[model samples]
Target: MRQEFTIWLTGLPSSGKSTLARLVEAKIRDRGFPVMVLDGDEVRTWLTLGLGFSRADREENIRRIAHLAMFQNRSGVATITAAISPYQRARDEARRAIGRFVEVHVSCPIEVCEQRDVKGLYKKARRGEIQGFTGVSDPYEAPLAPEVVVRTDRESKEECVARIMERVEELGYLPRGQVRCEVIVPADLVDELGTNGSSLLAVLASREARLGRAGGPVTAEEWEKIEQRLRALGYLR
Candidate 1:
């Protein structure tokens, strides 16, 4: 059976959470995995109507979505949730509810989000037309230690997607035998290391000899540590 997991994208409005979720959904489908996207706005219209913008209501909304994501995960399906999910306590509750959760923090400043607010919601919030709005009248508590953090303000859409994809692959959620190893190095280091740096080559060779006979790719955290060590050793700039 395929391994199942939930990818939760939480951030301020217009932070590119939905865009990244859609891109990830498409990539998962292309890789032959069953995936579902539970967008916040669409869910509010469908599953969470009659719920106001109060803190209690917001918690209930996230709870409902987390339950749904858990259901999909039980059926061997991956779920991508793009929600503002403004409270740390609410997000912690959701993570507890769904054991296999991967929190992806879609980080962008409120100023940028307001500028990208094509719906004029932010303008209204500023003028007191909208009350209890997240990142405006209300608060937006960001994730302290999410599985992945994508800064939409600084990164292109494609780069954001790539970062999420790398996390998904690291988590062993990709289809079996379809894992792709990506080595990220600085521009200056790329020329010196070429296609394979000595450190990376050694790591890959060792993993191939071990896991090739066993199974699975290296964990994302482990790869990150390896990269850090390489950087410290001057192998990566």
Candidate 2:
């Protein structure tokens, strides 16, 4: 059976945790890995609908999700959870419960999160319409030493996803000696591709498979560019 692990993404609302989780999940699934994403909002609606946003209720919510993640991990399924897990103690407990866990701190300033809030939750919190909202009326204890930290305010979604993938590789979650290659196209060239660039890579990978090549076809220039960026981002040695 494949190695199993859980990636817990903790951050404030609108901090891009869910978005990053989905991106990571897609990449892992594309590589033929068994993966699942436990989004906070969906879980709350389905599993913990009666639970309010009080500190105690939030702790219970996290515990429930952590137990579910642990169950999946024991079955050799990789689990990714995105939640505004406000308290550090609750997250620590989760890490203990889910033994092969990777804590990803999805960080962004409260101001930035408020600006990106499409649901108007932040505005409501600011006006005292909602109580115990993380990063607003309630406290948000940032992770002290998470395995990975992605700054959604400063980095692009692609970059954040790449960083997490690098961590997964380092932790040996991916197949042995198989490092996922992510091509970071320049912004000016992004429009030229006319697709998300994954489609292009998929085509190249398919051709390589037909040719029996060990690795996909990435030009020397492209490889160098990707390596340089990864090294600069401290993802590669």
Candidate 3:
């Protein structure tokens, strides 16, 4: 997106929040927009150093992130925060602080998150090694009404990214160009695919014949075909 806005990524630890944040950052950056990713782990080390896992400290951490995001937005830089941010109040506070905020709830079951845990944090929390750990000792208040919700347990990275971008685009936070259907036959292979009846588009039409496919936006190659047809009839040079 060309406009600077904060994309707040909140979820339980190991719920693929960081992964989704980086994927979104890369996708927006590819669109010629620079995005800043404020990962929770990295922020704790640099920004909110020596912060504990208490509820107060958690709110303070989110406050600090919100403060930074506001400045970034002012300076025309979009921010994506990948934080556990287990409290709803803290997230709401941040949203109010940053007017152009989009909260994305990276959802995954606790069992799934624990299974995907690489740091053995869940095991430690279970054994009382880490005090007030979220999803175990401390409560995780999931967002009741978030801008976007992606279930990492079932959806692939591409699916999750598409879902997030679609919602952001709908909300006018992302550019229209960023939401175009990108998988409509790769540009390089479009010529080889041809206008044959057995092509991918034809196959899709046949498969959805019972449902009756409606006309969609024209692709670059489809426009070229129109131009070629007009030229063949001597409409233009």
Structural similarity to truth (TM-score) of each candidate:
0.73, 0.73, 0.74
Question: Which segments of candidate 1 are over 4 A away from where they belong?
Answer: 175-237
lDDT of 3 by residue, 131-227 (tens): 8989999999999999889999999999999998888778877776634322224453355346442333222222222221122333445445534
Worst 10 residues of 3 by lDDT: 205-214
Tens digit of lDDT per residue, candidate 1, span 54-163?
88889877877787777666655679999999999989998999887899999998899989999999999999999999998999998989999999999999998888
Clashing pairs in 2: none
> lDDT of all the models against the reference?
0.75, 0.75, 0.74
Off by over 4 Å in 2: 176-237
TM-score of 2: 0.73
Model 2, residue 86: C-alpha shift (Å): 0.8
lDDT of 1 at 146: 96
- What is the number of backbone collisions in each predicted candidate, taken in the order shown? 0, 0, 0
lDDT of 1 at 108: 93
